[model samples]
Target: MKDAPLTPPLCSTDAVLATLPAGAGDLPGAMIVWEGALYIGTAPGAGEGGHARILRLPWPGGGAVEPVYEGPEGSAVTGFAALDGSSDAGPALYAALAAPGGGLILQAKAGAGAFAPVTEPGLGEAARRWIGPLALWGGRLVAAAGRAAPLVGAIGSAELLIEADDGSGTWAALSEPGFGDPGNVAISLLTVLDGTLLAGTVNPARGFQLWQAGEDGAWEQRIVDGAHRHVASPALTACAAGEGELLLGSGGAAPTAADLPADAQPPELLGLDPATGWELIAGEPRFTPEGFKVPAALEGPGFGWVKTARICAILRDGATITAVLAATPQSARPFGLPEPGAARIWRSEDAGETFVEAAALPHPLVAAAAFDEGLLLAGLAGGKVRLRVAT
Candidate 1:
């Protein structure tokens, strides 16, 4: 793949419309923007010793962040979804929490002031595994569990749960035969596209793959051989309804025996067709900011060299797609814990064909979502959350 030139940088100076109050040590988790409000989930802050909480910040101009519920310590909020018109009580916010015992799912009204724990419909432990990556689709809540196994020769499985408007639901095991022999792959991310459930997985060699589920409970795999050079974890963002398109972001580079070139580009964003089993429509290695260079001397712990960085979060608005890149450059010598360069936000107006730097934040972004037209919300590693709006 050929490298592309860096485009003009977009500033977040006039874009930062507001900053809400978050806990001292809280880490941002899943976020969803719906019906004129921004809902955010948080993990335990550095010092805060309690279960994670869901906070809602009024949209358009609402400036305060308020907690909706608080659970046990180390119980982090992982996933979120807004239930359909099943209840007269308004929209229901479903959150996934990583607790000491497997995992927990909680449901609450959009503006009910608080969340009440509800037994997740159809939850079961086939072999006792950790559940994560939750998605709200077609008025139903779906979650997947990553089977715990050794680093090599590990396999993963997935389950689907459907919760009724009244909170009643059923759980069924998804047969993803395309994922080799079922127990050989691990599912990492789950999303919904065009009334179907989609999942991404990592093979033992770190290669990326995709799978989809139909209404009949049948799951099929979509493979894109040689689409990514190294490990490419899938990052799913929204697309126009009925368009049958999904945006995917990956930071893993093409496998290279030598260090990355000085002009090495960031991960490429691509469009996938869920109905056709995730056909690759378009993709390109994203570009870094102009004048932003990666030092050749930065490396990781033992190898004394940082291999590749990955894309963490993505926000798409119309034809424009923005990506947050976290890169760790390979270092020739260790400088006692490298700062890893500053994180950059890249924007592509024409799908993933080309890109330019949209913003530069001091720290790496852990999570991000499109707040509104020309507005973006970013949660950083240092427990800082900021809102970026058009100037």
Candidate 2:
């Protein structure tokens, strides 16, 4: 997965920080920075409408724009994790909130001022309520609730992978809920990489699945549906680890069924290799149980178009990674959206091996950060939270 170039554009100053109209949070899922401050979290737009806040900003040196933490009306903060034991207030932080059957987790530190509720909402289960992604393994924290999607919050439909313990708000159930596959549905991403913990599901019947969790915690199931490139599950959103492998990023085609032909699958940039195998750096050219694959991007897969949806945020930065290339509301109302920007940016300075296609913007990042000079994006688009400061 390494031959393909021509895809460069990264200047960015197209910042907006907050312009989230309609009930305030058009979309801006979890991001973090802590001490020098740069929080960001907000989600709920389009039928859920908005009410999931947490914007701080003032990092590497930029200011004003506070909003703290509000969430409740239709809820949607969805994920964040830090934890460092008992909290003399330096690390701790958990947060989830997905509302509906009432899903919650909150808890903060690093000079904390607010963010409490240590879990009571759906942690016991009222159908689980969509709580996806948030990582940190054996030391606890973890997360990945379920109700899976549709009304967005959970009243039942399976999905659980819980953890928590370090600061003990007590939580368990490492798998079994949907791990037993009620057709999987929403585990979306948990990530640890390197030390390995990963869990990415979204199974719209039989596609997206990745799971991993050893060292006695059990849980395995490497890559099923997507290994077949059944691409559909928010185009397999994000996953990042690097070096030894595991840097998945498919552009979420977000269709859900309008005749579900795998929601028009088109978005790829994978490379897992090292156990269950499966490589394909671009997309389209399958045949796997771990065999054929091919495409390294000569504009193959969505990287070249067909509506570049999926890969909403990957972020790495040591050997350089940075993905994020969204486009979906069912591909902007029924077919091939690309014209006036839907969100774009793809890079890879050797970590994920290879990639290009840089900058196109208009919103669609979930979270990003990298500063020594600047590179801090927090997009959710139309629900606005846009802030791409690369200068």
Q: Each prediction's TM-score against the native?
A: 0.71, 0.32
Which runs in model 2 stand beyond 4 Å of their true positions?
1-69, 72-76, 79-179, 182-186, 189-235, 238-287, 296-311, 314-344, 347-376, 379-386, 389-391
lDDT of 1 by residue, 221-241 (tens): 554332443333322222222
Off by over 4 Å in 1: 1-13, 17-24, 45-50, 86-90, 120-129, 147-160, 163-170, 176-186, 224-244, 252-266, 274-308, 329-333, 336-341, 371-375, 379-391
Q: Residue 217, candidate 2: how far off, in angstroms? A: 33
Give the per-residue lDDT digits (tens) of candidate 2, residues 323-381. 66655433345565534555567676766456676676554445554444455666544
Cand. 2 TM to true fold = 0.32
Assess the local accuracy of residue 139 in candidate 1 as a C-alpha lDDT between 0 and 100: 54
Task: State the local distance difference test value for candidate 2.
Answer: 0.62
RMSD of each: 9.0, 18.6
